[model samples]
Target: MIILGVDPGLTRCGVGVIEAGAHRRLSFVHVDVVRSSPDMSQDLRLLAIYNGLAAKIDRFAPDTVSIERVFAQENRNTVLGTAQAAGMAMLAAAQRGIPVALHTPTESKLAITGNGHALKPQMERMVARILGLNEPPTPADAADALAIAICHALRPAGALQGGEREQHLTPAQRQWAQAAQRSSGRGRRNADRGM
Candidate 1:
């Protein structure tokens, strides 16, 4: 499957394309910031991102798009810009009817490093190992994008999920699922101990 992973940003969007199959994963392509122009107005910047990403979508013809969930602690401006950039990226995918998946930083880190607490360097190493890269990617953005790709690639098809479903996954559902999984795992571990 051809998957396009995106790290969305107004001035420095990072993109990576990879193919996964039964045996191994291959990075058929990778991209970072189709263009970087700080002088552009906010609207122009968004449109630039939209247009540039549309071209990428045309070129890669990806079957699926994987995007990182925007996390904002203090900077509302950063969060909003990121969401806009992400929205444009999603629009590109949506226009083509391609599936789009969203992954949290923790989920991406866990998929790569077996731990959500993984450091950036650790994630870089994991991404390299998964893609068979001789060296880790620079700028961290590319590495993050690659990590997002790896998350979906490793997940079961359809189970990887698309952004369209994000609005429907309520807090109650999340809490229930988490609680169920934790209890199930705890039971399994206890059973193993008893045996």
Candidate 2:
């Protein structure tokens, strides 16, 4: 299965493509950070990002697209831009009829480094080690994209299919799944309380 992972941003979007082979082996096919100038108009910037991601989807023909889920941030501008970029990624995948999955940064970090709070350098190192690269992918965004791809690639098939997947997950995956559940529960509780 070919998977395209996107780390979306208005200024710099990271794209990584990997192939999942038999026995869960992964081979990195491409990694790049697409850049847009801030000086450009917002609509133009978004267009640029969308075009860049769409081009990758067309070139790679991935069976699925994995993207970083945008989370709340203190900077509203940053959050808005990120959300917009993420929307572009979703649009590109949907236009091509490719399955799209969103993974949180914590989930990706835990899956890649066994720590939900892993630092940038740590994530870079683990991603490099997993891909058997001589060094980490550069500019943090590229590494993050690869990590997101790895997280989705390593996930059990049943997990995505809504069956008894827990029985097949590795120990680390179980932990990640449990944490995700707990996090979602908290969000629900907060929503119920009108927070």
Candidate 3:
């Protein structure tokens, strides 16, 4: 399947297109930035990003579109803007009837680095190795956007499909899951020690 991953931002959104097979050895088509002007109004910048992304989507004609889930931060404005940018990209894919998948940053980090809290540089290194690129993609944002795509690819297929939807887990859910994992690990350790 061909997947176009978007890292949506007003100043410079990053995009990466990858294709994979049933066993899913991924292939990279392109990874680059969509630049916008500094002096432009927010609306115009968004429009430019939308149009540029639409053009790339047209050019790639990917089978699926992957994007980062809208994340909440202390800065409401930042979250809203990222959500808006992501919304525009989703709309572009919706116009094509392509499936859209949202992945969390943690999921992306885990998929690429075996750790849920991987640094940007670590993610870039994994992306570079996964695609066998001579070097990592630039401007961290683009690498991050590509990470979003890679994250979706690593999801359990049944959970990803079959009418299931992604929930942008809250901090509480994350904490609970981590605590559960710790509990499970302790159980395993106890069993091993007894054995």
Candidate number of the best TM-score: 2
- TM-score (C-alpha) between model 2 and the true structure: 0.80
From the highest lDDT down, the ranking of the candidates is 2, 1, 3
Report the C-alpha lDDT of model 1 over 1-195, residue by residue, as the tens digit: 888888878788888888887765566467566554779888999999999888888898988888877755626767778888889988898788777777777778777788989998888887887887788876666778778878877754454322324423565774665577577664233222211
List where candidate 1 sits over 4 angstroms from the true fold. Answer: 24-28, 72-74, 156-195
Candidate of highest lDDT: 2
- Could you tell me which 10 consecutive residues in candidate 2 have the lowest summed lDDT? 186-195
Candidate 3 has what TM-score?
A: 0.78
Q: Can you write out model 3's per-residue Cα lDDT over 80-179, one digit (the tens) per residue?
A: 6677778889888878777677666777888889998888788899998887788997766688777777777777655442111322334576466557
Alpha carbon RMSD to native, model 3: 10.3
TM-score: which is higher, 1 or 2? 2
Can you write out model 2's per-residue Cα lDDT over 38-100, one digit (the tens) per residue?
Answer: 999999999999999999999999988988878675367688898899999989987876777
Q: Is candidate 2 or candidate 3 better by lDDT?
A: 2
TM values, all candidates: 0.76, 0.80, 0.78
